[model samples]
Target: MSTEATQPYQRIVQDVRQKIRSGLFTAGAKLPSTRELAETYAVAPGTVQRALTELRTAGLIYSHQGLGSFVTDTASETVGGRTDDWMPDAVRTLQQQVRDLTARIERIEKGGD
Candidate 1:
């Protein structure tokens, strides 16, 4: 997928992963609904779903059919492994931030904001 297309979902994934690692989102804590997340992130619900899928695949979260997603009990342990292992994810997060900022700047320059 193109970086522009992937950036929104990756941004969600990185934010949630950081919350998990920081213990801000404790085990069993419910996540916001997909619609809520979409609104908050200013992306489509499908984008939020894509982000959730990544988190689930990473073992950081799980969902119930009728219920909302929740942080996995092992979320912190899964994300807080060796310090060296965090470099790639950290780099991706920084890159995402830069992209987001660039987009905002372009919008502002065009008087879209």
Candidate 2:
């Protein structure tokens, strides 16, 4: 996939991290599987795994052999230097959201008599 396509993976990772920190994922909550994640973002499983690996390396997620990955209790504190990893993804996601909302409103207007 092109760089543009992979950008959402980073954004997804960042969004997940936020959820964990906010207790949305909670400690030991089983996150969506790589396949589910890929389906949700229309990306390859490899891309999801790559993004998960970043969370794992940052100590924000833990994976069991046969089970699944989960958010850790102390993930926020441990992510430390990796905090800024989400900036580009967030910015891009924000930009896309604005564009999507704008387009939807435009389409609604265009249907008017």
Candidate 3:
């Protein structure tokens, strides 16, 4: 399915994040230009720009104005004293998953399976 039809900016942010997290976009490496990502993903450059903005806010990447955005080194100091946005979401998701699993196990033990 063409998931890009909904939430284009979110999809762009996710694609870039996945690439960085997967090591496809490396630390200190420049990301695809807004024009390039927009063309490749078949979306407007504004959408790509919004995605880049989100990444910058999350501290996973930064821009150089004359240059392009680059993946920030994990150990490097963050821009604007921020932490990556994905980190908190992942931690919460894991916590919720653990709780769900415990509840499921309790149900199974109680013969609710």
Best by TM-score: 1
For model 1, what is the alpha-carbon lDDT of residue 48?
97
How well does candidate 1 match the true structure in TM-score terms?
0.67
Q: How high a TM-score does candidate 3 get?
A: 0.62
Per-candidate RMSD, Å:
16.5, 16.8, 17.1
| Regions of model 2 farther than 4 Å from truth | 1-6, 79-113
Q: All candidates' lDDT scores?
A: 0.77, 0.68, 0.69
Which is the leading candidate under lDDT? 1
Better of 1 and 3 by TM-score: 1
Task: Give the Å error, residue 101, model 2.
Answer: 46
Worst 10 residues of 1 by lDDT: 92-101
List TM-score per model, in order.
0.67, 0.61, 0.62
Better of 2 and 3 by TM-score: 3
**What clash pairs does model 3 have?**
none
Query: Please, what are the lDDT tens digits per residue for candidate 1 over residues 69-107?
Result: 888666787789833344576564554445445645765
- Give the runs in model 1 whose Cα sits over 4 Å from its true position: 1-6, 82-113
RMSD of 3: 17.1
